[model samples]
Target: MSYNDRFIRACRGERTDRVPVWYMRQAGRYDPEYRKIKEKYSLLDICRNPELAAEVTMMPVRKLGVDAAILYSDIMNPVMSLGVKFDIVPNVGPVVEEPIRTKRDIERLRPIDVEGDLPHILETIRILDRELDVPLITFAGAPFTIASYLIEGRPSRRYLRTKSLMYGEPELWQLLMDKLGDMVVTYARAHVAAGGKAFQLFDSWVGALSPRDFERCVLPVIRRIFDELADLDIPKIYFPGVSSGELLPSLKGIKADVIGLDWRVPIREGRRRLGGGYAVQGNLDPAVLTGPMAVIEEQAADIIDQGLEQPGFVFNLGHGLFPEASLDKIAALTEFIHRYSARQLQNGAAAKEAERA
Candidate 1:
């Protein structure tokens, strides 16, 4: 139960020997081993295979020396059970076979049968729990993000169709959100029961909405999901990617255990705006990992220094890892975070002792 409590402690807003570091997409093509696997199997193929998925999930923890392991599966995986046909088109991202629009479309959506429909994913979590020394973070796409894909049918620069559904047909929007919310909760709870140490709900495209729109259309469903999961002892992380600083005020109503910040927001300022209560994760620019070691160290150190001021903080990139990012640089960054955080904590302890004397 106490395998790697450092990440868990940080999630609980407790001090640790060193700051825990884990990249968002740590098990992707950046790792040569994963690249080899990709050569043989497609992304979705690998995710469907519990044995392979478990192997990929553990690869990053073993290679990069991260403090935690996130389940290596796509957020769209759960939607397949909802009867929404989709494809993880190689370079284009998720492509829905039939985009949802009308009230009938929402009615057609089915509830996810986690154990019966997604047994492989649950088995993958079980394998990771039995093998990994660090905490395992299971994840699901938040209702809004999943809705964007469902409505737009693919990745979008402007979620025009998604917003149309929300603004034009609020009733249909609520119906869709209600269905997706239930699916997310069901999928996430099954993951926890199987052996996940924590849960992360990725609202990756939520920034596309204005604060008013988010408060009106998105907040309630997200609140419902977290409120449903509040009974679980594991920390629930909410990541609303990019341009989310303006929406932080509305996020206050969300009941997540940890609020993850994208690189656009400074950790210190995010803490101030978020009211400094719940644990926070991330805000590091992932591009910094490819820069010179000197620059990387300088930038990472700045984030670490500011993040240490928070009651609970976990070190992570603001976004997922880039395929072109250097593994050597990531390894160095991990080592530096541990060394730097350890020194900082030690100095704080010494200063406190000296003051006491």
Candidate 2:
């Protein structure tokens, strides 16, 4: 069976027949089938079982006709391999058994040996590689985002404890980042070697810091992760979450292929802000999917128009899909993206041909 490469091509600043569309967290909650699976197993349980994980990962692709499939593993999966105990508690996020703070906690962290610690995840990627024609995107949390989880134990609105550590113990903060960064590099390599076509570094909470703080406290480690993995030759996407539009200038030096945008920034404006060299993904408001169908169609088309004004654009939501997002809406939007972009590309080619004739 043939698969799609439009998403991969777009990520590399290459032209394609149409924009590729896939949502973050596309495989979970919204789908009734996934909810049935959830009744049988917890989120981490799915991650631990390669077959189950692959099944969940492919659900959105088969059902929604998304152009790509992200590995159905949590960002905290690698952290657990590093010896941190945590649970994906219902109604809450990752709740670390003991938060990391001092030098001893950092020292206690072990280097991830992917084969030994995460064979299940690698096997899942291998399954996806054989089963998927579209790109199999594997991702891990960015150092700063994972660091927040490690320091705070759970999700927080302000990330107060994380910021305090950055301000109060700069050296210790570097130590933690170094460990997590190295782990991300190794984990990413493993995923690629196992046949992942792309990788996304999800710094979902990194926007919590000010520009100065992000540069000082966070940027270096992320830079290292991308640099170390550059030779892999896969598209590397940096998802810095909301407020990342403001942080783009600071991140210009990082070696990543695409900068994901949240809905707060217009895609065209984000393209200009990123200095025009890299491709971009997203900036759609996911909430719109819950409203009227006509409104969703209008907004999705507008995003596509803005995205195509430049080269290397991928159509996606600014963030992950919410639990309540309509599956029907997702399918309709995807079909529209493929059809509309193809028509646009075809018409452009015909016009150029007429000029030559």
Candidate 3:
């Protein structure tokens, strides 16, 4: 009932009554209400209306009672400011109208004009800040991930064109990463200024690179984005997307508050790889939600237990929610994480007190 900062506290590695929970794509088609709204208005259409966008963003907060509310927006939303035209095609994902291939195309990208081009987005953040009980996480796609879409022109499985450019045209690749990094730095500043309580940089496709290639190609840009935002006091998160376990050890001083783990690595192990400098979030397999309720609780408890072993941890899916994921199951899972972790924490505190006595 009261304003809950459990999510925020966890991000800062503070102890709480329980492990806070929020899914990656929490406000999605899985909810019957969201589906009904989608029938009336497209995802982009909903985003253009600030009041409606804010309401859609809060749907899961009211329904499943998540600890944080991520802004309901496409990562591509900011690219329009860079003069790229794209569409979020139904069932396919983001599709670029004109793919960037040449050096001139990369140079053509302008610094993002957030207030001028995406006023509705900032307005939505303002509305959510005034209304929500939970922290709002405004996000931007990391340079590599955004570059993947912009280069490939659509949802890609192999990213052949993207990698060809990265490996073949190294100088050209740096130029693109630089501009995209600049856009993220500028865009994120605007979100925080507009009242976003926290920020996440979604590098959802960066895991595609080998550790050597990622470090050589993308890590500099990643480092710069977080470094530029170091003045923002809110928690910052870096989700390196699926299969990113191998990429963790290289993130030594990226300045993010949390490093999101895919289910490929256990929470404790992921922290070890990250060298324990930052708080950790996620690694729960989102697919486990489609299984039996018992399976869901067991898996969630395992993650929560490992999370409770440390001070800074948040409960969340390893990745985005599936469209067919059950809403009832998600709501039940949230309650389980809250109730079970709270009891576990209380028991541990009592044991410590007894020892002191």
Candidate 4:
């Protein structure tokens, strides 16, 4: 309505009228308007123009009535400041011009100068901060996921090249992770300073690693990113991406206020694995939206039911929404989450009052 801080309240583990719902990649190819814009401007092109980028972001908040607005920028947007060359190919994803293969390549990464090199990104945040009623979630890719592209040159089915570098050149991998971690902290801090209300560190590919490797090789940098930003008053989120169920236990003591769960694990089980002390977001399979509206509500009902069992929960997809994802379904699902969860909350309160009586 006026200003929805429901998402922020849930993240801080505070009381909310209902569970807030916002999907990853909520503002993308899924909408026809965005598709038209995509034909004219590349994802990077839109991001480089703050006005256009802010519009792309707010489209979802207006259309679907989402609880928050994630910035319409890619994780690799900051890497250009670090002097990496990559392109978000039409269907291929991030393709590195020169994959970081040696100590030389890793060392070659300069520190990010966000205001100097990425003025447009900050401008986009400033625009959204003034425009939107919802909190603006600005994000960066976590080290391992960015390194997966930097090392592998492109997305790999097995991430063999990424692991080979991690296993064979442990010191080199650590160096790369350190540099990337620094990039994320700088980039994220700049966003918050530039008027971003909250932040999310997307470690999308980190789920590919075993829990042992995640702890030994990746978790330190992940922990450091949050620790560096611990002073910020706004909510911080770490989404360990799809298939990250096994890596949950290894993520103990991460300073994030919210931990995102992919759909592979149930919400309660994912929370159980986290061992407490953070609000939980997501685990809805985005593919479920392709089915009938009745089917969609049935599935969303299960996630909301499990979510309402706990104090801090936000309704979201386990992963980003795909191009084929229906706008109508998403809008309807948003309405369903708000209405259904409100009634559930009211009923629960009534039951508790009855017990007291």
Q: How does candidate 1 fare on TM-score?
A: 0.98
Which is the leading candidate under lDDT?
3
The whole-model lDDT of each prediction reads: 0.90, 0.91, 0.94, 0.93
- lDDT by residue for model 4 (1-357), tens: 488899999999987888899999999888999999998999999999999999999999999999999999999889999999999999999999999899999898999999999999999999999999999999999999999998999988899999999999999999999999999999989999999999999999898999999999999999999999999999999999998999999888999999999999999998999999989999789999889999999999999999988888999999999899999989999999999999999999999999999
Question: How many clashes show up in model 4?
Answer: 0
* Residue pair clashes in candidate 2: none
- Please count the clashing residue pairs in each candidate, in the order shown: 0, 0, 0, 0
Expressed as tens digits, the lDDT of each residue in 148-169 for candidate 3 is: 9999999898999999999999
Task: Give lDDT tens digits, candidate 1, residues 1-357.
Answer: 557779999999898999998889999877787888998999889888999999999988888899999999999999989898898987799999999888888899988988887899999999998998999999999999999999999999999999998989898899999999999999988999999999999999999999999998999999999999999999899998888988887878577889999898889888878876788899788887778999989988888999887558899989999898888888988999999999998898899999999
When sorted by lDDT, best at the front, the candidate numbers are 3, 4, 2, 1
Q: Summarize candidate 2's per-residue lDDT along 168-198 as a digit string, tens digits.
A: 9998999999999999999999999999999
What global local distance difference test value does model 2 have?
0.91
Per-model TM against the reference: 0.98, 0.98, 0.99, 0.99
- lDDT for model 3, on a 0 to 1 scale? 0.94
Off by over 4 Å in 2: 354-357
As for lDDT, the candidate ahead, 1 or 3, is 3
